[model samples]
Target: MARRPRLEPRETRLDATQAYLGRAADLAAEFAAGIPPRRIRTFSEAAPDDLRTALAILSEIPDLGLVVHGPRGCAVRAPGVAPLAVTDLDQRDTVLGSGEVLAETVRALDAAYAVTAIAVLGSPVIAINSDDIRATVATLGLELDKPVVWVRTEGFRSAVPATGGDAAADALLQLVDAEETEREPGLLNLLTSTRGPELAALARQIEGLGWQVNILPAGASVADIARAGRAEASLVLAPDLLDLFAEGLETRFGVTRLDVALPLGAQATTAVLRRVAALGGAAAPPAPPRSVSKPLAGRRIALALPTSWGLATAELIGDLGGDVAALSVPHLDRSHAAALASLAERWPDLQIHVGEGQGFERTGFLRRNALDLLLGASDAVAGALRQGLPAAVLDPARLIGAGAAEAVTAAVDSAFARLALARSAAQNARPGYTPGWLKRSPDWHIKQEVR
Candidate 1:
């Protein structure tokens, strides 16, 4: 029972559960209580796994070796996910202890590559199996003379897949030199959860505010992550998985945490810009007056994305005069109080379907509702096309900073411009579900979880 790094589960720490089946008001109402009542889907399909998330985040840090201490299944098939060395724990290792497997992988990674640091990723199997690897990890760190962190990411630990981001943050905290807590003047942490291509323009906009930006965990090296403690403040962006991350920085290093709402549209982006500029004692340059145009006028749109992305994108749609008919998000938590309130106030009748990857519900929405566009990169978007709904696939990369509104508007225009393809797709569409199932309510399978 050696001392392990601080790796608190987002479920226990934030009371952020991914299990909810409700609308905007239903979910927004739950915020009245400290912990929202848990809801479960009667039927479920694809969902986010914490392990996959942790692996993705960790692997993104260049030259950081990772070992997945789980079975081969969870370790492999992480398409475009990792350069991981999995323990591949067998029945024998599960019973006899798999520390050696982890140790061997760590040694192999260290011996072969010039990695800045090494991390051991946990999994559901290892969580259930309860094989301790703390002592081994600490010994490896000392043995290799590099940062070796244990990212506690069990797939089933939390309903919100973003909880894996929290785990990765917790593990990454070990890299920050706690001994050097002196604040670096004008250094800002542009904390985000997007794996989209490099965000040079976004960083430039922040740098225009007179602060050097440290874009973390995404396209960041081990050194960039290491110097995070000294940043003057942190500005968290969309994909709102940085609650624990920013909190940890503030708590540990006394960095200012500007936990603002996701900047998905023009107005919200300006607000974020103004906030960041004001922090660096620099005035945001005056711009021409915003001209509001309703490109999506008379159009009804539905979205299936992460909570922050859903709320912010929904707001962006509203800003552009598009009618947001429905929204499907992964999970809802207290951190979404402001965004939820804003959405509820603006579109009181906005229907909200909460779940990560429930294709049936998404398909049902297509069968029942008349939507001009469906916003998501999920298979449901294809279903929408087959059902004659124009869909603008969401890219988390473009949904930030000054160009967010422009990017979305362009995407919407492109989607609608190809309306003929969508109509043809619907006309020639093969049957996916039975007519009876189509007639039933999309959430007919959803039932309130009785306590």
Candidate 2:
């Protein structure tokens, strides 16, 4: 009797499980043991600590209301976003658990809005008091028709800010049905932040290839999320924030996720569209044509962005004939090792600053190096400008497609032309830190931690 042919093992892509948070230097170092341990200033408005990150994620979900299960201060609102109902636990309520307050708030929010889902978020006060968020949500769910999700977002628990977003995504995934359905051949679930002009352009690109794009959580309704299992596959626009949600979708409904770099530059955008088109069994459309009025040749740029975005931005800068002189990443993890390696190969001598609020270090670096431009978040851009350097805030929206590429080129040219004006303003403006103090070792404030 002939033995049955050996079954081939199916290839599995690296999902969010293998990810881990660490200092940027440790991540970039060839040997982790050889690297010096240091605690850099690790806070920024872009992140604003982990609690804010969780709140921000929940706020983006359309028609989903939030209940901050803590004191009035914990009920911090994200500007122009979702409505939040706070428990407003006081000293008396803290002594005797705020369960009643939570219950009342949930009921009030349920009556106030026609929300499809309600997220009950735990703040530091409630977390410390050991408030039973799960129990409260379960009890409330019995009376309410809408699904209630408990998001654990205690500020001190998570070291990496993105974990807060992960928790929010996990809670959102609870709303998705477990049972699989007939897959929609030309439907793609775009796991991203929200609907914007950039996202619209990306949707159009996919639509051009005969595929329909579903923006999750952002503009997605409860019905859309419930039927997410039917999509052909999920594509992560901002993997750092949405990879966990994508992984959850795949696990629950057999939906595959295309884990690729964001569609920032020409190469990355083309690669994204090609992979998406292939996944949906649609014909890949011709790459959009780009015309650069002024190429970034011989220009040196420094970037301050998250790892994934920074890597893609570096590639875009390179494609436009500019050099990524230095970059600052919020946190580095194992999940980014492959991309980091690729970047290292391209720029062997790239300078990487780890953590945030390193204005002193950034100022010193800009003054020391012959940098042409600084591209980063608002704070970083302002810091660069105050140092008499040409700078532009790195807008994620301006990194989508050919039109985005042109926009970036135009922004760079504009910043370069305004260098003299920026320098004059810097001379007149009151300095935040003295040049002498900034001249100290870039790691002057960083304390080494031996683990």
Candidate 3:
């Protein structure tokens, strides 16, 4: 068992380190060189799409409005759960400038919603035109009483989708008052995306310890985000997604961070609860013995999931008698290095693929490997199912606590039970891709450089 690092107050930028964490140094090196075996599809979401993620995070706060300063299409992407407005920019505005339109949009949102705070998000069009959204918001702030924050969402400039989330966090932190306050003991900021049953289950576990859980981003109010500075510490659930956000909070608010593996499966989850309890000065509850199911014995499983979930799910699958044949992570960075190293220690021979939209490579792997189960994101599951493989979409948020583990066990058993039916459907359906083409090297499309 890996010993947990002691929590310490420090001033450091987490993103200053490499993001990709993997035991296989060679594979990480290959990905860094941009010569992975297969080319993947480009992510369609621009930076503004992060508004969906940002709004989801901010949704916990009541009556907070988001003003998207771009085309109407941009506003359409914003989840309907929150009050939103769009600048409705067109060709004329793009050629000229949309500053006036943005000011009008903010004014309209202010009049329309009784929100405590409003976030102004820039779209790809604004980024392309290099519109000074910050300046516009600043000019409006001079007159508007409510705080107006500008979140940079320049999707065309970066490939990483989470960059927009980081931008939102940074902008949101600006709204947080820096004045020191008496630290609230046993108060923790749970920096993660938790929804539905998982949120309820995890909340019970944390609250059961007599500690207050403040879930950030998801469902967090503007006040909750601002008050995060007053928490005893911040516990990160999705380190890969929120490490930079946590770092920002720590730097600006003096709130220390507990960087631990995501709570998945019996052991990892136990570790998380115990650590948080200890940090909150509560007694650590005795962990129940883990129950392993033998249904997956002798089975090979492949995973395509977010970084933290991918690592934790691998452990759960292993406990359930499944051997992880391969794993696909969206992206790797410095935040993931420790987890990657830990995974490497456990599965030295594991094949790790890092990229977004690597359906081609996944298909190729499914063709070559005698995999019994394919668990991953919806796109990956669809690709595997088309190839007649029994697959399940791994929604990490939905898979929490021991109940979630059991649910996954049941899901695997059910998928295997219906394997024949899935196979028959695949056989009857028109094949999406030719077998010969799939059998070809994933690098087939690439022109090799000769020395």
For all predicted structures, in order, the TM-scores are: 0.92, 0.86, 0.84
lDDT winner among the candidates? 1
lDDT of 3 by residue, 1-451 (tens): 2332322211122222111223365554443554333322322212223555555555455567788777887766444356877788899998788788888888888888888788887777876688887777777777787688777664453445555556666666766766757677777888876566876688789989988888876677777877888887888766655676788778867788886667776677788889888876788978878674565678888888877788778877777777887887766655555666666666676767655555665567567667788787888777777778898876888677656577677767766787886687678866755877677764344332233
Give candidate 2's error at residue 255 in angstroms.
0.8
Q: List the residue pairs that clash in candidate 2.
A: none
User: What number of backbone clashes does candidate 1 have, counting pairs of residues 3 or more apart or in separate chains?
Assistant: 0
- Backbone clashes in candidate 2 total 0
What are the Cα lDDT values of the candidates? 0.76, 0.71, 0.68
lDDT of 1 by residue, 341-376 (tens): 788888777777766666677777555666778877
Model 2 Cα displacement at 40 (Å)? 6.1
Q: Which candidate comes out best when scored by TM-score?
A: 1
TM-score between model 3 and native: 0.84
lDDT of 2 at 293: 38
Instruction: Assess candidate 1 and give its TM-score to the true structure.
Output: 0.92
Provide the global lDDT of candidate 2 against the true structure. Answer: 0.71
Give model 1 RMSD, 1 decimal: 2.5
